[model samples]
Target: MTDTLERPVDAEPGRMNTRPAWLALFGAIAAFASAALIWICRAGDPSVHYVSQLGATGMPTAPLFNLALLLLAVAAVLVDRATIARGAGYVVGWPVATTLLVCGLCFGVASVITCSPGCPVPFTPGSLVQDFVHISFAVLGFVLAIVAMGQVAALRRRPWMRAASIITLVAVGATSLTGAMIALFKGDTVLGGNLEFTAATLAIAWFGVFGLQVFADHRTARRRAARSHE
Candidate 1:
């Protein structure tokens, strides 16, 4: 007797689903748009303030920034479904995907319940309970995303996936350390804020790269299938 392997019901062998790729692209665009809007709407040097401060209470960019977060959350949910539907060649497992979904939900919560000005953390003077809640949501979301990336990197199946994940993890980690130093020791605000922004941009770009990879896989599969028929 010979053994046959099972495949996802929604996916044809060797064919990559394009929905997740498209969703990720859309999410990245929305995220960048929100950041851009903040830069344009604000008066002071954006590099000196935390990114969250742009969306804090009474800021001109707050409304659109929050709106973008909501859009991203929606995109993330759709991406999760699309990823599962792809059924093959996806780097992360369902557990990791679920983690991403939770990360998206956390962003949504942060959008709805924004922090006060300066976006102070818990137990700080002039900090409201909602501020802590907002910060918690944002921190949890980013941490989960980093964790998911680490999990995918551990797979080491695709060279590009592994490299991208590792690079993003390192970039994010380095900036996070700077951010901590700024919080703890009054480090260079400009450097910390700029590094934080750059890390976030890199993460979003990497996600877009993943989407493009899926698209490439789809094209390759089509080419192979066509050659087989010929």
Candidate 2:
């Protein structure tokens, strides 16, 4: 028999779920974490051509991403323990550390192989090849963004939340495709190189936001859980 006693109190008309509200909050955390990862990677060296700047800028990138990835990995699994995504989320958690290590190695190698001593010249086939290699890491970032945004959309409360999640997902996919194109057309030409890099940076920032949204979603979810309990 259905237990009326177990039912939560009368529904509040426009109130959002504590869980969902908490979920929305996770998005912000994830975004900041991603930015942190970028800084970690870039912190190494500034004078040399690195991830975005010159030094170890890419250093923070990996660590920050791992932080957000871990957070999303943890909460996503909890919220959908019965869903197929639960299995996927668990898989995501284990890879967080590996991703940082692998991305670091790939980017570092690419950096060295691409440019001669620093990364001043730019063109060299070596650099192109390196860019190609690093593309895979970028692809992973894109994939994770897709899943994170979709998950949020599925759990969102406000109409705008769903809209934002979907828009971000679409942007991630489009940016990835464009990034691939940019990777293919590398050179010293100001038009090609700068444009591609600008696009890539924008895409990365977008992915950062995707992580933020994921954190926000988690916060919203926790809130809902608390509300229900009350």
Candidate 3:
């Protein structure tokens, strides 16, 4: 009798687990697609030091690229929430959630706050506060992205997730270092931009893959549960 009562309850999680994954997956696709469009639109612009620079005033692709960042931010938050819902909550879940939240909010704010034309050049003598704020948010968002990746790598039980997390960590680390170098030297803008683009791509890819995996895992679990019940 107890087994009969508990079986349905036990099956509930499996049945419901895929919902968050779907949300995350949608967010990932939106982020990546928008970012790609921005890059394509802004290609060959020498003045842009990083992807975020594309969203600065006077840039041709400013509005579109900024919109992309907003989409990516939303997607990141969804992915992080999904992680928490999956029962990895005790592990890296909370850390991932917090970092992604930071990433999302920073990105969203930075999108609205346009940088000066010559951003990453130490701000002009009388730059607007928005310029500095944009830089701060971008830097913090990237850093949190790296932290989230590391935590996910350390705590995820799935082999594929660990592998993806490790790869993302490497990509994000290289990108962050390259960005820092650009900031210090104010040189190699192209290289810095490329690295930033790559890092963003890897981040969205990881989120998409992770969400798909979670969704697939839950679907399998549900199927198995249904069979067992039969």
Best by lDDT: 3
TM-scores for candidates 1 onward, in order? 0.79, 0.41, 0.81
lDDT of 2 by residue, 1-230 (tens): 01221222222543433443334344334434544554454454332232432321244343443343343333333223212211233123343323333433433343333222232323554344444443444445445545645654554244575677677667656745564565456533434434434433443454345334434544444455467657
RMSD, candidate 2, Å: 9.4
Per-residue lDDT tens digits of candidate 3, residues 78-175? 76665555443325545566777788788778778878775544456867777889888877776777787787688535667778889888977887
Clashes of each: 0, 55, 0
Cα error, candidate 2, residue 129 (Å): 9.0
Residue 115, model 3: lDDT of 81
Kindly report which residue stretches of model 2 are placed more than 4 angstroms away from their true locations once superposed. Answer: 1-30, 33-135, 146-158, 182-230
- Point out the higher-scoring one by TM-score: 2 or 3: 3
What's model 3's lDDT at 200?
69
Q: Which is the winner by TM-score between candidate 1 and candidate 2?
A: 1
Each model's lDDT: 0.64, 0.40, 0.67
Off by over 4 Å in 1: 1-25, 28-48, 88-94, 218-230
Give the runs in model 3 whose Cα sits over 4 Å from its true position.
1-18, 44-47, 93-95, 120-124
Error of 2 at 31 (Å): 3.3
